[model samples]
Target: MKKPAKILTTAMIMLFSLVQMPLTQAAMITTGEAIQAQQRNIDRDNLLSMLQKDELRAQLAAYGVDAQAAAERISHMTDAEIAMLNDHLDEMPAGESFLSVIGLIVVVLVVTDLIGATDVFPFIRPVS
Candidate 1:
């Protein structure tokens, strides 16, 4: 190739390479948001831990939800969902029925799906 053509080809290749590279940017977050995020993560971990406990898992099985499948499903919950659930856990009164809480969570997930926040189940119709 001629000199000008060679330079143009090189320039085009460089431009395309730059376009193909990913760009990263960081935005400032409020302290409250940061705390909320951390709490959400903690909540998610605690919930997953509870689900994985053998005794609790056996109860979940009795409720007709497979332990592993329930754990996997919980893994897909959004941060807000997790935080809301965590708040519920934190506020649970002593001696309240624990199995009901798990069942209520399943119901809430189904309701969340109906509200279009998630598409985890196929049987429910999501609200528009």
Candidate 2:
């Protein structure tokens, strides 16, 4: 009788251990899942930077947005705002054009000297 009771207790312990194994695995969160969750947080922060620009915030308010709610909605904004920001930058004047204007002035002066408008350059003697 004692030998049979000891065997039965040992079998029950083994079965319990087997049942707990699956539960432990189910409760475990994978490292990849944790990294993905962190990445999502970083993405949300980037979205907020775009949506929280002063000009963009004012534009949203003009469209009847609640300022506080606008901040909350940043995480949900689509790529449309990014597209609009890109378009806005495209519409700005190019800084290099100002330098081009100066070059044009120098070319005009050289052409005028060649045509005898003024004998400003000693190398170019006027027709006299």
Q: Per-residue lDDT of 1-128 in model 1, one digit per residue for the tens?
A: 59999999999999999999889888999999899788777788888888767777777767666667667767888887777777777687856536666776677767867998755566779988
* Candidate 1 global lDDT: 0.76
TM-score (all chains, Cα) for each model: 0.64, 0.42
Question: Which candidate tops TM-score?
Answer: 1
lDDT of each: 0.76, 0.52
TM-score of 2: 0.42
Model 2: which ten-residue window has the lowest total lDDT? 97-106
> What TM-score should be assigned to candidate 1?
0.64
Residue 112 lDDT in model 1?
A: 69
